[model samples]
Target: MYYIVGMHIHIVPNRGSRPTILLRESYREGKKVKKRTMANLSHLPMHQVELLRAVFQGADLQPAGLG
Candidate 1:
């Protein structure tokens, strides 16, 4: 049996501006690894970003304005 799970931030380049920050999930499918969008953190505040990081680190979180 085998399985893979992980999360990380993705940077998407923009034409003439800063790249967008996206939270992504990575997993293994058969012999290939794939990534999926989990959230977009470009517009989040620093504190919120920290909270999201905590959530990804297995902390219990409550939905406030993260929608």
Candidate 2:
């Protein structure tokens, strides 16, 4: 069985291609651990990405406003 433990933002650098930032989560499938991408964050601005990283790291931040 696969169970997610936690999630984090990951940055993948390429030799000739543009870098990609992804939101990934750590999971355990049997005894081995693995990671899976939850979202692609490369399209978002750097500031927003930083905020999300902080939130994922357990930072205290205000809730988003409802529309």
User: TM-score, each model?
Assistant: 0.61, 0.78
What's the lDDT for all of these models?
0.82, 0.90
lDDT value, residue 22 of candidate 2: 99
Which residue pairs in model 2 clash with each other?
none
- Which runs of model 1 end up more than 4 angstroms from their true locations? 45-67
- For candidate 1, write residues 1-67 as lDDT tens digits: 8676899766688999877879999998888989999888889776776777687788977677885
Off by over 4 Å in 2: 1-4, 62-67
* Candidate 2's TM-score: 0.78
